[model samples]
Target: MRNATIKDVAKHSGVSLKTVSRVINREPSVRTETRERVERSIAALHYQPDPSARSLRSTHSYAIGLVYDNPNAHYVISMQEGVLAACRERGFGLQIHPCDSSAEGLAEEIIRVSRSARLAGLVLAPPMSEQPALIACLKAADIPLVRILAASEDPADGSTCVYVNDRRAAYAVTEHLIQLGHTRIAFLWGDPHHGSSSERFMGYADALKAYGVPLNRKLVLSGQYSFDDGFRRARKLLAVKEAPTAIFGSNDEIAAGVLAAARSTGLDVPWDLSIAGFEDNPFSKQAWPALTTARQSTSEIGQHAALRLMDLLRQNRDGHTDSSVANESFVPELVVRGSTAPPRSASPRAEAPAGDTDSID
Candidate 1:
């Protein structure tokens, strides 16, 4: 069946198109009775306003843009959902723009796109958010922007942005392993260009330093955020003379890869070795012996960023400035699951017991 449109509501309510538009925008010109009538007709017809049509009729566009360069599909999807929810709630349109942050004239390209689309503002995801040049360009063009950043603490520099405390979460994960009596812990790096990787590394390092465990350069490895990289790194780590009792992957994808590698080699997880991950993505829970990891709600973070962007747009339009809506921060929750425990060395038993030995195939 065809969906009800704004015109349908106007016709059903015996009101002019202008009146309906006023009611929809919540303008005060319409009488209370007329507004109630229009609203009732809207409910009866289930009318949904078209953002594009509304934008065409107004001087200011009601559209918002989401710009990101993330490789993780799940992360991108969650962020998109959050932004879309805020847009729907605020009666704004959303434009999702996936562009290469490293491309030449990247800032110019985004500014052009935002202007041509008549977007009220933009929500930027890292490494786009981390790029100062892009931010400078957007500000020079008088475009409003909200950023999502990864940091150990709130990096509130007078801009509206969402901060994810990857460093603190990583500290919690490392602390969990340390408390379980694992000294030889391995750290896998995600893409260094992304701020979260470095933040997580710092947290892990901080935890190790605080617990009197000497940082082992040999156990720390650098690689991109991927299951394949995790597999290769895990193989190398297992081959070493003194292997780490626990491995911390920067994200869940990498942790799942390590699990695949361990299973393929018939090693018992959490007995032969313990594994932990960040983000707590689905693969973490779905993996046999669910991965112990940290939880960060990507959806909530994205939604919060988009909502703040909309608020900024309102502030700019109304000529009233409020400093209260500044940088908001979130720390990921640490989750303990079946994939981690005290290493066999910590136990009195000389032999390690069997764990999830099922092959990845």
Candidate 2:
């Protein structure tokens, strides 16, 4: 038996070949009634469009690019899965590119890759997404882009973006610690280059202020977003004369490090010490005592970004001036786990007495 062709589907749907082509390619111009008719006819005949042949006839590329520079392997993988899901549904290909945001000629490098691949659009992750100069360069090159950013409000930079309200989520996490009777909570900050670290810090500070808890500058330490950085900072915080009973890692990796630090120092978790983290990554669950953290859906965010980029690409291709992409934002919700509890004492106490109670003052 022979396979049904586009002409056959067009005839069955009572539409022209052009209309069938538009419906098959998912162009937004097709009328709702016509699109349904084409879809039904295609389904009835089990007709499938040849992606390779369509690409050969079209000027626009069928491949989209996902560009990121992040340290977390788990996060990157999750994001990839989301983007891949969207691309697969639309019969599009995905190209994953990891690069250093600070490297010289970064814009040129991106442009070169896009030109070489004839990319349809691009999805950018933090640090890279937040860079104004890089975004300007892309815009000048007429590249359609969607950014995943961490900020309290939209930048309104004339680009499509998916904002993650890290500040709100961080505030909630800090409030939870305070409610658990932890007055002396320490904060382990992530990389400064990423805007999320700053936003999370703002949330933590705001929460402390709202609760009338004094912000102890000594308790805040800056570091990279990695398990090793978290581990090292946790050790230092634990060794302080008046150790904090509870510690908040910028993300789950750091929180897991705090757990390790507590165990190494012979301190009982949530008894002698308590720890919390942000971003409900695998580390939060796999730890001996699961981490209390915020659930940021990285996959969902990635999927949103990719879908928005595709919309922008379609609009650009159709040469319709009206913007089809809407700005989207996500706020991670708090997930209470076993890793956090009320502090053992209301007053600062020493895990190992250094005989310096004065440091608490």
Candidate 3:
């Protein structure tokens, strides 16, 4: 069967092509009676507007862009799904753009991308979203966007952004371990460049402090956001003369690495050493003993950001309301799994270190 088009809807409704366009776009100027008539005809004809075609025919494109810079494939995919979902709801198309956040002239590059794509607006994900300088530059150019950032609260005043409370979630993860009678907890860090790594670290620190557990700088290790990095760090931490009773990987990948390291070194999880992580990735959950971690709804946050951007675009196009950015906040929920438990009654140290982590300085 031939697919119905905008022209077919206009002809069926006895309306001009322009009128049909206005109706499809949901313009405020369209009278209710005419809109209903056009809608009925659209339904009867089973007509669907080709966003790509309409975009080419007009200055305002029917598609938006999703910009991100991250190494984790799972994280990237979740965010893309969320943004794509919102685009479908508004009858818009999506363009995924992955770029290096550290590149020179980044602000200019993004503005150029939006212009070249003829995008209606943009939805930005970290670490680009966390860059204040880049954000300022884009805002100066008046590009419509919604940003997703790792922050405990609004990172700016009079700005529109979606913030994920990584700090809070990290705190909860650490607290869970602490409550399990594990005072000698080791903290692992992902990339120090990303704000989320620091936010998660702060939460871990807060939990230790609140519970009167003395901070042991030697127990803190730094590494990238990867399984290999986690495994390497875990090996080093475990080899120490006096290792942590519990280990907290900043993310699930790291936590999974820690789990592997523990088993390889003949350490019994939850009994000899407790291990926990953040970001409940699927693989982490499917591990031999499911990981206890915080559930970060990456897709939901991305979806919400795109939805807000859509609203911003509408308000701007209609000139009906202020287009000031809305600052939104979200927090991850804690999910306790099989990986954590109370510490052992006695400290059974791993083999003395071949490479010392006695002092992390």
Candidate 4:
């Protein structure tokens, strides 16, 4: 038996090849009735479009590339899920490339990958997305790229971007702790390479300032966006002579570490000490007592980035004069869980309150 082709689908539906191509590509110009008829023929034949054949027929490629240098596996997976959703819907393929952003040949490596893959467009994830050198290289290569970045740091010209407002989300998390009567809150920071760390720190600082809480330099500790880093930094913080009443991890991984550190020291979470985290990743919920954190939809952000990249590719292919695509931005909401609460007492050494098991949501 022979395989069915686009020609067979077109013939079965009594339509021209161009109409079949338009319908398959989901172009909006196709009439509704004609589209339904073609779809029916396609279902009857179990026909699938060949990406290689389409690439050969068109000037542009059908593959999109996602480039990132993030350390969090959960974050990477979520972003991939979102990107795949968009790619599948648009009849496009996805190629994921993880690289070192600090390498001297980073830009050259990305350019080589883009050329080799013959990608239609690219989605850049932070901190790689924030690199000026890489952006320059992509622009010089004349490649269509959309970046996912911190909302506060997006370019002024409104270039294609899916922005995550880490600063605002961080502020909300910090304010949540403050409202719980936590005056001495500590911040566990992520790697300096990531722009999100700085944005989140600014939000934490802003919340404290707004509430007239003094910013204690000793309470801020530098760490990576990982469980091990969080655990190590939190252990040291817990050992301090005047430990903070509340701890805020730059990400959920760090917050989970904080939870473990508190447990090791026989301290009760949200009773002896309160803890919070950002990015509402799985680590937040899997903890013994769920972590109070900011809920940023990483998957949605990735999907938007992919969609924006496709839009840019379409505009370029159609020779449209628009210089840039619209930007999508989101401020993560605060999800109060069991991890944070008011200090047991005004003093840091106050013992855990008796039989206190109250949790928020």
The C-alpha lDDT values of all candidates are 0.87, 0.88, 0.84, 0.86
lDDT per residue for candidate 4 within 1-361, as digits (tens), equals 7878999999999999999988876666899999999999998998867667788888879889999888899999999999998887666889999999999989888889999988888999999888887888888888889999886545565458888888878887887888778887999999998989988998888777776678898999998998889889889989989998899999999999999999999999989899999989999999979999999999999998998888788767767876577787899999999998778755322332343311111
Q: Count the backbone clashes (under 3 Å) in each candidate.
A: 0, 0, 2, 0
Better of 1 and 2 by TM-score: 2
Order of candidate numbers by lDDT, starting with the best: 2, 1, 4, 3
Measured with C-alpha atoms, the lDDT of residue 314 in candidate 2 is 78
For each candidate, what TM-score against the reference?
Answer: 0.86, 0.89, 0.86, 0.89
Compute the lDDT of residue 331 as modeled in candidate 2: 95
Better of 1 and 2 by lDDT: 2
* lDDT for each residue of candidate 1 in 1-361, tens digit (9 for 90 to 100): 8998877888899999889877776555789999999989988987777788778877878899999998889899999999998887667899999999889999889999999999988999999998787888898998889999997666667667899989889988987898888989999999999999988998888777776678898999999889999999999998889999899999999999999989988889988999999998898989999999999899999999988987777666556655236788899999999999899858422221233111111
> Could you tell me how far off, in angstroms, the CA of residue 110 lies in candidate 3 after the best superposition?
1.8
281-301 per-residue lDDT for model 3 (tens digits): 886778878989989989999
Which of candidates 1 and 3 is the stronger one according to lDDT?
A: 1
For candidate 2, the lDDT comes to 0.88
| The best candidate in terms of lDDT | 2
Candidate 3 clash figure, as a count: 2
- Decoy 1 TM-score against native: 0.86
TM-score of 3: 0.86
Model 3 weakest 10-residue run by lDDT: 352-361
